[model samples]
Target: MKQKIESKIQVKWKACNHGLKPQACQHWLKIYFADKKVDELEKAISKAARDPAKYGIDQPALERRFKWTRTTMTQVVEYTLQAVVGTA
Candidate 1:
């Protein structure tokens, strides 16, 4: 299930007009999640993403990158949560 969600995010990202690879997305998710559980990460990002300013300058791009069904957000959220939880 986790793989499915993450894969969806990857797929959405690949469909973007992005010049760089999707690694940046993964990297950012890692940094953002740093110390949270999978579910927690999802909850965190989903909530925080409500505010563009909080997310910062790359907002437009990142927001578009995550454009898609629940899958993209699911991936972003889950990955972040897992990374955070792992660190903790």
Candidate 2:
């Protein structure tokens, strides 16, 4: 006998800030720190918050709007994982 395993993941973000939600910011950070852990994610967001231009955030004010705390990042990751697993 043989067995097969497969998985698929899909994510949807609400239409807010022209799709620039915190989750979206996380994704943007992920593009740069693909193999990094949550700590790195927190660091990246923090850096972006301070210097939005470096992260390609054109709107200077919006940089401070994202919830860049470690707790928020952890929650976002957990929520995303739950959503993916729920879909599977």
Question: C-alpha displacement of 59 in model 1, angstroms?
Answer: 24
lDDT for each residue of candidate 2 in 1-88, tens digit (9 for 90 to 100): 0011111121232222355467655653453243246557667666776777777775544444444444555565565565445534
lDDT of each model, Cα atoms only?
A: 0.53, 0.47
- Residue-level lDDT tens digits of model 1 in 1-88: 5565455545544544465446655664554444234456456556657775776635665455445424655666676556435533
Candidate 2 collision pairs: none
Worst 10 residues of 2 by lDDT: 1-10
Q: 12 in model 2: Cα distance from truth in Å?
A: 7.2
TM-score of 1: 0.26
Q: Residue 80 in candidate 1 has what lDDT?
A: 51
